[model samples]
Target: MTVLNEPATLLNGSAWTSHVFLGEWTPGSGGDYAVVEPATGKELARLGSATPGDVGRATARAVDAQRAWAAAGYQERAAVLRRAGALWEEHAAEIEEWIVREAGSVPPKAALEVRTAAQECYEAAALASHPVGEVLRSEQPRLSYSQRVPAGVVGVIAPFNFPLILAIRSVAPALALGNAVVLKPDPRTAVCGGVAIARIFEAAGLPAGLLSVLPGGADAGEALITDPAVRIIAFTGSTRAGRAVARLAGEHLKRVHLELGGNSALIVMADVDVARAASAGAFGSFTHQGQICMATGRHLVDRRIADDYVAALAERANRLPVGDPSGGQVALGPIIDVRQRDNVHRLVTASVDAGARLAAGGTYEDLFYRPTVLADVPLEAPAYAEEVFGPVAPVVAFDTADEAVALAADSEYGLSLGILSGDGLKALELAGRIPSGAVHINDQTVSDEAVIPFGGTGLSGNGSRMGGIAHNLEAYTETRWVTAQSELPEYPY
Candidate 1:
């Protein structure tokens, strides 16, 4: 195995850090993680673990840098991001490799993420021009207007599922709103984030102190929240982790934006095509190997048609090529690693052991698990009850619309939902009744267009992202009522 002594340099103008200063595990500590090539079980790189101290230093730099960056004014700030976007586009190819190598993301997905990163920077730069608040109406009582200002420094703790996308979602918004960012990305996928930042910041001419990236494990995340300097925290991960981040940030009275876990329920009524529902089911559950938080895992089908639906879905799923991600024929890649593969395996085994009939795939082994589909799996089964974030799709038949609604709303997570029904009007009615963040009548969950506020209800997330709700301004700034026309208080009473 080859160890890159100078993995890469972090740039803040001409100065650079040679070795990774972000608290990597030392040789003797025995805390080493590998980034493997998914196509072949070959080890690509070995990374040192990140310590808590590294988190503190990174947080301090981001917090301290915010003052100067916020003071740089709109024009200077915009110029930096603009340059960063240009550089990112120029070096997009190298960044794509980092993504595929570290996160094991397929080429199509990785390339799209790289392009999206550039677009995010470009979009954020544009947002810098709009004043946060303006005069809505002017009347006699008093001059009333809301002005948005910086929320100090923001702490972003992201996940590995879609490293580039999640990082950009948090970083771009915070920066556009004039908040200095201290980002703690997934330890397993730090290289992707680091290189992306380097390209954008290098091109944009952003002052060094404005952005700080510290990549490590959970301890680094905890440090970012506990610090007094970080006034806001934006996290995307498991429900357990989200809660901890929220609790810590609350202690400091900081603003928090969280996108936690989810287990989506895709409903299909008798009105829609069984083939269509089956098609949607395979794409939703198997895409990304079911790692996405918003992926559909539960299928609440109309009782009269459940059997046919499951059969067609099985056929569709089995037909899709599942193997090495590099092959053009394969639509789905292997499970991230043995860790998640095992997790899915355990859940399915318990469900079967508990008396739930296994309908399709029961095959599970090293590195990858075959596409899993479970039927006659009761609503109470662990696979059904909890988030089955794997290539598992369990279909449960429901008699009436009320039953379907109840089944769909069974989980506390309200991330994203979809319904397949011929009647568009009925679909809309059902969507309103079911409590999810976003709903689609004829399309699948990944059918997310760039324009909507993509988030969930209850435990899914505290708020939304994307889709012009790009009020990232809210996350990064504190609103202050500006009184241009000064007047003394009428009475102290």
Candidate 2:
């Protein structure tokens, strides 16, 4: 267990050393990969790439045990998930530490995820036990009932950002519905997510082959996706990668749920509190170094408020504490790697050269890029059109309601959008008109459960991961209607 040793050799869930070409965590195979400390140029863990063989074994294990698991009644499934939830609550501290270390998240942010996973487990357990379809009323003596059954074995491909939370969003629902999960975490930060799954499943007394985590990169993913035994695929990653999965899954006619890229916007109106709105908007765009899919990338402010709001936002950006992610006061940490830092720097430079104004930071020091805020940014600039997965937020001014809505909705990726306005009525109006999957009024966009339906219309993703009743229905469901007649007709047409 990870609680026993922080530097323990990474496990492939079921065993210690990897058995290559079969579901195992082989050390140094596909490519020599290293887990780096985001704040420092230090290597914490070295891993080998997951070969095709590893994927075959993992998929086989999940497929082998899927039928019996699906046969297990909802009551039994709920009971197991309840135990897993209790265990997750008990080991929150340990899980949080691993998450922060491997994923580069602040301790506080990581702790919340541990709590969130437990809550999702409980909610999924409740959802699993409840009957999905209802009885219908008819004139003829007939019976009708619908069942929401598991989609057989599920393959989860988790991302680096919010590993545990993102992983749990799908896995818990899969488990509660009595589906076996073969999770392939982001190779760079797999330990934390893998450990959490291992601990929860063990505590829940799940059958050995019912759940397993294989930490691998592309080769591993390709193997799993191609396997015919895998009935369902849940992926969270880039649009390019998501497209590949969609194509591959289409050929096989396998079910897939994708949560892909984002180039979201934040629109601030003239009536809002300039100072507070600027601060909130800056944080939303730059938080986690802007690596998250829901992170705000585009900024649209009313022309009357643009200049003053930009100044306030710059000042607020300067106030953010920068240092190690593990510290208490540090709100901003270094980017995940030098490659991302260089990419972000290039994006900022191109924006400035293309006529965007640098309102605040637009410089870099090694892995840390200063929190950048750009003004007078045009949609023509590359930064304006693409998803900038970094700390730079480009701002553009708008005068009319039509102009403001047009600027925010201009991006091809429509993941999430935030709005700030004093007039709640106007804010709601704007929210309704925005083209993205979710809209926030008088505040920055966040992954809220009860309030918004989080997702996108086009390049952002094909499906929503978490939200309200629709999300629950989408995750684990199959619809079929039955028509019955009490008086049987003897004549056949």
Candidate 3:
């Protein structure tokens, strides 16, 4: 293993000779691509993009490694993961810095990502020794039981936003369940998501070839998905890409888990604290430049207090500091790239053209877009109708509870929703009416905990849960029933 004295230097414009891992860092036969820092458009490194052949070789290695990994038993697996989790905490500073530099994550958001990743590792470790089988009673058989077995190799394709944590959320669970994984992280945050994770696991004494990190674009993901050795695909990205993965994996009859895009809504009821709800809306809509899948895309406020809520939200949005992530003073950092920035601006401009009044911000300085608030946005506007994954919040007024529920349920994506109301029972009632995978009461839409079933419905996902124990049991395992007869009865013909 190549150990650097100052591992933080890896984040600075260092050239990587390999991207595919098979027991070690193996050079890719494909072309190299530059890893551009989204915050500054500077070249952090040039990483080799894996070709189809490279992915196949990695999959074969994983297939071989999975057998011994499964037989290693849960106790051994738990030890390795616990060590990996400790390593993650030890290198928290560097990992946080990498997230900010590569993915343009703000300081606090980056730190949270690191913290969450480490916590996921720890959480996954606990699953290693947990009971994975159940006793069964049969009518005729002497003994009957069902056992949960690993799904062999799992393919993990993670997105740039919250890359490390998202990847860890999938990878750790698969590993803990005794499945070898080949991860293809988003090319944008390859170092933080790929290299950093590989090193940590390798140092923690995980068997070589058990886990591989390949940093590439769509080609690598397609290669992993199509490989026969891969039994399951755990994907977190846009709905378009998730659909493609689902379709392809279906052809092979392989299991797939997707956590896709969401246009979550934050509904402020008439009896709630308008200022607090506005603050929650602002944070939900603009945190991490609003790149989160569960970030609030629409603010549906009661018409009676709509104006007051809009004013409070606008004040908070305008007061937020926006600049380079390295400055350590900014709450909002740059968008992922020029295209993303342009796409966000286009949506905002189109909403304004459709008669939405911009109340706070509608401007950009370089890649850093100011937190924007638009009030009285029509339902048909792109900001309200689609996933405008930028630091923009479009507020729409609703007259009644039914109208609020209708507005929230009008989206094709049903990942998450936030309801703010003084009455807990009312919020609970409304949460039940919304058809989303997760509903937050008295809180913002953008919330994730490792212990919860994290996934989505409809276009948001394929209904395969990630995080939590249920996801671990479902995504990484297959059930097998075993029956034994103490005495064989005479064959009746």
Candidate 4:
């Protein structure tokens, strides 16, 4: 293990020492690619990129390593995860710096990501000691039981937004359950998403070849999904990309766990204080520049108070400062890149052109997009209909609770939802009528816990959950039924 004190040193070390870890520090056969800071648009570091051939090689090495890893004792595996958790906290400052720069996260958001990632490691450590099997009654005088086994090599594909948390949530659990991992992080966020994880496991003394971090493009991602040695795939990204991954994986008869896109909604009841409700809505739609999969894309307010709610929300959005997070205090950071910024601006522009009122924002200086609010937005408006993935909130009025339910359920996504009301019972009943995977009463939509089962429905994801002991067990392992008898039973031939 090597000691690295600075982000630059760590990245340079990773580039020179190994492009992709395959049991040892090894250079990539593919060429180098530059990493640019989203906030400043400056080249941060140049890392060696992995090609499809590199993914194939990594999967082959992972298949060989997984056998030995699965044979290890549960305590040994648990120890590695626990140590990794401790390392995350011990190196929090350096890691947070990497996240803030590489992912364009505000200081608080970056810190939260570090904490959540550490919690994920600790939770996964506990999974190693959890019940792995069940005993069943036998009718033919034989011992019968079903036990969980590793799913061999797992392929993890993580997106750019919330990179560290998304990648580690799958990586830590898969390793704790005795499965080797081949990770493909988006090339733009490769260091924080991939290298930081590899370094943590390396320092925790994870066995060689058990984990491989290969940052690459779609070619590498496709190779990972199609690899025969990789038994399971855990993907967190756009709905389109997830569908492509699922299609390819299905063709190969491999299991895929997807956590895709969302156009989540936050409902504001007429009974609540407009100011308080607007505060919650702003937090949901503006956090991390609304780059989260669970970010509130729509705000459904009772028509009687819709005007007041929109005004309050616009006030909050106008006050929030958007700039380079590394420079000073700011409420929002830049979009990941120019392309994403253009997309966000395009949606806002198109919605306004189609008669949606721009209540607040709807503008940008370079990549720093202001927190935007669109009121009286039509149902068919692009910002209202699609997942903007930006700090833009589209507000639509609903006359009754039934209308709110209809408005919320209209989207193809059913990831997360929120309802704010004075009466908790009414909110609970309303939540029940919605089809989202997770719902919050009197709160915002963006929420996650390491111990909770996290996933979505419809186009948001497949029916697979990605957290907690039971869900992680299901995601990373396979169940096998076995029976034993002292004497051979009478056979019918």
Of the candidates shown, which would achieve the greatest lDDT relative to the real structure?
4
The order by descending lDDT is: 4, 3, 2, 1
- Local distance difference test values of all predictions, in order: 0.72, 0.74, 0.87, 0.91
Which regions of candidate 4 fall more than 4 Å away from where they truly are?
1-18
Question: Which consecutive 10 residues in model 3 have the weakest lDDT in total?
Answer: 1-10
What are the clashing pairs of model 3?
none
The alpha-carbon lDDT assigned to residue 277 of candidate 2 equals: 85
Scored against the true structure, residue 202 in model 3 reaches a CA lDDT of: 71
- In model 2, which regions exceed 4 Å deviation? 1-33, 46-49, 136-141, 450-453, 463-470, 480-493
- Model 4 lDDT tens row, 1-493: 2233324334445444436666565677677788889999888877768889998889888888889889999998999898889888887888788788889999999999889989999999999999999999988889999999999999999999999999999999999999999999888888888888988887788888889999878888998998889999999999998899989999999999999999999999999999999999999999999999999999999999999999999999999999999999999999999999999999999999989999999889989999999999999999999999999999999999999999998889999999999999989998898999999999999999999999999999997999999999999999999999899877898
Question: In every candidate, how many clashes are there?
Answer: 8, 2, 0, 0
Q: Report the lDDT tens digits of candidate 1 across residue range 422-488.
A: 8888878888887888788787766543334667788888765543434667667888886555676
Per residue, candidate 2 scores C-alpha lDDT tens digits across 1-493 of: 1122222322323442231212223453455566666776666565445666766766778777777877877788787777778777777777776676677777777877888888778877786776667677767567765556667778889988778877887778787777888888787676666656765665566766777677776878887788887888888888999999999888888778888888888888888888888888877888878888888888788899899988998887777776777665677777877777888888888988999988888887777778889888867887777877887778888999898887776777877888888787887887787778777777786564522245676888885555444565566555666766677767677
lDDT of 1: 0.72
With candidate 3 superimposed using the best TM-score fit, by how many Å does residue 119's alpha carbon deviate from the native? 0.9
Model 2 Cα displacement at 450 (Å)?
Answer: 8.3
Error of 1 at 38 (Å): 4.7
lDDT of 3 by residue, 295-386 (tens): 99999999999999999999999899998888669989999989989999999999999999999998998899999999999899988899
Clashing pairs in 2: 21-53, 22-53
- TM-score against truth, every candidate: 0.89, 0.90, 0.96, 0.97
